[model samples]
Target: AQSVTQPDARVTVSEGASLQLRCKYSYSGTPYLFWYVQYPRQGLQLLLKYYSGDPVVQGVNGFEAEFSKSNSSFHLRKASVHWSDSAVYFCVLSGPNAYKVIFGKGTHLHVLP
Candidate 1:
């Protein structure tokens, strides 16, 4: 079975500061990793995904992550953050079939003014 674990339940960052949201996965076969964000009062949006190819994958709003098979980790990162970035972030994983992804509870992000 495949699953995801987001170690940080919540994260806070000052505007224009760097941010990192930790995530780990457990899977035996092929792993499809993804980072998703939900803005205040909004639905979840895909940040990035990794299946094959480059270890580091980029996403919208200057978000990026690196896939580490050995560590079994895929962590989301951002060079800078904004107030609008204050939202809930989720790390998800899917098998080769890519059905309903298994998601972490979510990490609540708070961007300070």
Candidate 2:
């Protein structure tokens, strides 16, 4: 079975500060990793995903994620975050069979101006 973990329930950061959201996964092999964001009253929107080829993929806005097989982690990062980026981010995983998708609890990001 595959699962994702987001240790932090909430994070607070300045509007212009760089942000890194931690994501740890448990799986036998590399799976399809994704980062999704959900606003207060909206659905999940994909930020970025890493399937194959490059270990890192560029996502919407300034979001980027790196896949580490050794650590079994896929952490999301942003060079500079804006106030609008405030939302709940989820780390998702799809197994090689692609039959199921597992979502993390989610990390709520609060940006202070």
Candidate 3:
């Protein structure tokens, strides 16, 4: 079975500090990785996705994620975060059957001023 784990349930950082949300996945074969952000009262938005090609993929709002096959991880990174970036981030994994996807518990990000 494919699974995604977000070790940190909550993370706090200064308004202008860099941020990194850890994500590790377990799968037998190549899997699709995705980082989705859900605002306070909104649906999940696709921040980035990785299927093939470059290991490092750029995403919206100055976000980027690197896929490490050796480590079985796909961690999201942002050089500098803003208060608006506060939200719940989910690490998702999908196998050949895209309909059946796995989602991590999600990390709640709190950006302090």
Candidate 4:
């Protein structure tokens, strides 16, 4: 079975500051990792994904993620954040054969003025 773990339930960062959200996964085969962001009252939006090749993938805005097969981790990072970046971020794992998608509990990001 595949699962995602987000140790931080909530994160706070000052506007314009750098940010990094930790995520870890467990799966037997090569895992497909993804990062999604959900704004208040809106549906989830894909931030980025990882399967093979380059460990780092650029996402919307200034967001990006690095994949680590050995550590079983795929953490998201942003060079700088804005007030609008305040939202709930979810680390997801696609099941084998792409049968199902597992989403983490999510980490709520709060941006301070």
User: In order, how many clashes per candidate?
Assistant: 0, 0, 0, 0
Model 1: worst 10 consecutive residues (lDDT sum): 92-101
Best by TM-score: 3
Q: State model 1's lDDT.
A: 0.91
RMSD of each: 1.2, 1.0, 0.8, 1.0
lDDT of every model, 2 decimals: 0.91, 0.93, 0.96, 0.94
The best-first sequence of candidates by lDDT reads: 3, 4, 2, 1
User: Residue 20 lDDT in model 4?
Assistant: 99
lDDT of 3 by residue, 1-113 (tens): 67899999999999999999999999998899999999988999999999999999999999999999999999999999999999999999998987869999999999998
By TM-score, is 1 or 4 better? Answer: 4
* Predicted model with the maximum lDDT: 3
Residue range with the least summed lDDT across 10 consecutive positions in model 4:
93-102
Which is the winner by TM-score between candidate 2 and candidate 4? Answer: 4
**Against the hidden true structure, what lDDT does model 3 obtain?**
0.96
Clashing pairs in 4: none
TM-score of 3: 0.97
- Lowest lDDT 10-residue stretch of candidate 3: 91-100
* Native-referenced Cα lDDT, model 2: 0.93
Instruction: Compose the digit string of candidate 2's lDDT tens values, residues 26-93.
Output: 98876889999999999999999998888888999989999998888999999999999999999999
Off by over 4 Å in 2: none
